[model samples]
Target: MADYDLEALSLGELKKMQKDVAKAIATFEDRQKAEARAKVEAFARDLGYSLPELFGTETKSTRAPAAAKYRHPENPSLTWSGRGRKPQWFVEALAAGKTASDLAIS
Candidate 1:
């Protein structure tokens, strides 16, 4: 990380620095998603929801729905399972252009 010359920074420069800081924070958040998924999965398991019963992405459908119901591959029981405070491998997979049907439920 480069040191910011705080004394030399103008208002515009400060705004640019703020934007850069925001970008860095967003990047760190993206990287932490895997850790978040693991935490959610563990919590879901403790709460008595079998992962497979919730996510149910194992079966392949020839005529899959254009927008199938999203589930967390990690916890699966989460209400907003796609992406949010909680993240899932299945959601990440779909984002990477792989269908949910391609991943085996474990």
Candidate 2:
């Protein structure tokens, strides 16, 4: 009823297939993580810890602000406040013709 020819796929079709395969792999990884979480929950029950006591979010530490300042390595003159997109100094340096290798993590 359905025609299935593996050899008839174009490059775009092949790329879509690769994307689908990657998504499937990611889904499998998520399922494995869920299974591991279930095992941990069971172990916590055996240890007499309440589910909330064992896995509650009541003890989370605050994350540091994203806008903390740092310097670029290759160009020590460039500084960045790690906020939204790429830093302005980095962009300006790139606009002035600098490669990614020209920047270092400071």
Candidate 3:
């Protein structure tokens, strides 16, 4: 760790440094976990097995992007796939006497 003259730093500089230190502390565990996983994966590969093969869990995204099913009336560019939580505009549109069919893309 580098020595710092804490008294010389301005409030802004000190706050920024505090935020940096907090972020570093938070990500340190994640970096260590990734390193440990890498080491395990290397060892697994040498033993003719993968981590996923042993654990039966994939670390990759397999779901493809869903096509947009609904669009904003005023904003044609704004769209939703009709999955998950409804967007604010979509909710407001429903409250404004617009049916889901009205928002459905043709």
Candidate 4:
């Protein structure tokens, strides 16, 4: 790894580097999980069995993504799953006195 001259770098450059580092850290976990899963699958295959066969098909790792539960009133393309922090539009809708039911997908 190259040594960074943090004091000599501009604010924008430092911010960009911070963002890049954050992204790399996030992806590293995913890469590790994928590598471990691959190794386990390979081991299972050597024993004439698949990972799914040993761990069932409905494992949390293979679960489907949450379906969107609400959409923007003006833009149908923008949606929310009603999970985690609400989207900007969803928050604005609530501030404007629109209930969750008002924005719900029908």
**Per-candidate TM-score against the hidden true structure:** 0.33, 0.44, 0.52, 0.55
For every candidate, C-alpha RMSD to the true structure in Å: 19.9, 11.3, 6.0, 10.0
Order the candidates by TM-score, highest first — what do you get?
4, 3, 2, 1
Q: Where does model 3 exceed 4 Å of error? A: 59-106
Model 4 bad stretches (over 4 Å)? 59-106
Off by over 4 Å in 2: 1-6, 51-59, 63-106
Candidate 3 whole-model C-alpha lDDT, 0 to 1 = 0.96
lDDT of 1 by residue, 12-83 (tens): 989998999999999999879978878878888899876566788667779533433455555656334233
Q: lDDT (0-100) at residue 42 of candidate 4?
A: 94
Cα lDDT of all candidates, in order?
A: 0.67, 0.75, 0.96, 0.94
Q: Which lDDT value does model 2 have at 91?
A: 78
Measured with C-alpha atoms, the lDDT of residue 90 in candidate 3 is 99
Q: TM-score of the candidate numbered 2?
A: 0.44
For TM-score, candidate 2 versus 4, the one ahead is 4
What are the per-residue Cα lDDT tens digits for candidate 4 across 1-106? 9998899999999999999999999999999999999999999999999987998885456668899999999999999998899899999999999999999999
State the number of backbone clashes in model 2.
Answer: 0
TM-score of model 4 relative to the true fold?
A: 0.55
RMSD of 4: 10.0
Q: For candidate 1, what's the RMSD?
A: 19.9
Instruction: Return the clash pairs for model 2, or none.
Output: none
